[model samples]
Every structure is written in C-alpha cells, then in structure tokens.
Target: MKSRRFMQPLTSPIHFHTAMIEQTPVAVFLGQEMIGSGKIVQITDYIVKIGNEFYVRDACTFKYAV
Candidate 1:
C-alpha cells in the first residue's frame, strides 16, 4: 500500500499577489481625489520606505543583450 500526494496549482506567492491586488485597491487618496495606484513591495509596523525596482530592471534590461 502507498499514500497519495497532491500538488497545488496556485502557489503561495501567486495567492499573495492575487490577494494584494484584489483585497486592497492601491491608491493615494488626497481629499476627494485619488492620486496613485501600484504594487506594494514592503511593509512595516512602525514605518516603511518607498521605492521601486524600475531603476534596477532598467539597468539590466539590455546591458549585455546588445
């Protein structure tokens, strides 16, 4: 006799991204206006730093491709 195993189609990271995008609509609210919308990279209890990996990807996108 042998035991069976199951594999999940969606991984944890996928679920996390789905939740982040669906549950919370990203936006910066200013009075009655919405300013911005984007993905969240990091979060903290007391404080958080703001930034994006655009610079990093820009540096590597075609550095050695050409």
Candidate 2:
C-alpha cells in the first residue's frame, strides 16, 4: 500500500512577480510616518510609506552571510 500526503494552499513565499519570488506583508507598522503607500517593489524589497515619510527595503540590517 502507498500513503498519500496532503497539499496546502496559501502557503508562504507567494509569487510576487513573474520570474521572482516574494512574501507580502512581512513587515508592517502603525502610527509611523513614511513616504509613499506600502507596496511590493521587488522580490526582496518593498517601498513603504506612512504619514509623511518614505522608507525603502534597504533599511533592513544584515546579520547573516551566505
């Protein structure tokens, strides 16, 4: 006899764009001022805007190396 495995939908790592992989709503904040509305700009980047300030995905700090 063979066993069957179940598949899941709406999993993580949702495709953000063609030929690219990105996860949405990874980072979010409230009552913070930024420029531009929150949007996914790149597979691994995002453009966030709050109140009157803007922030790019490059604001994150690095801690691990490949």
Candidate 2 least-lDDT 10 residues? 2-11
Worst 10 residues of 1 by lDDT: 57-66
**TM-score of candidate 2 versus the correct structure, residues matched by position:** 0.22
Tell me how many clashing residue pairs each candidate has. 0, 6
Clashing pairs in 2: 34-50, 34-53, 34-54, 35-49, 35-53, 35-54
- My TM-score estimates for the predictions, one after another, are 0.29, 0.22
lDDT by residue (1-66, candidate 1, tens digit) is: 321211111123443255345543233333444333344354333221123522221111111000
**What C-alpha lDDT, on a 0 to 100 scale, does residue 58 get in candidate 2?**
52
Once superposed on the true structure, which residue ranges of model 2 sit more than 4 Å away at CA? 1-45, 61-66
lDDT of 1: 0.30
Query: What is the total number of backbone clashes in candidate 1?
Result: 0
The per-model lDDT (C-alpha) reads 0.30, 0.30
Predicted candidate 2 versus true structure: per-residue lDDT over 1-66, tens digit per residue: 321211111122342241122222223323342223323444334533333444443553111110
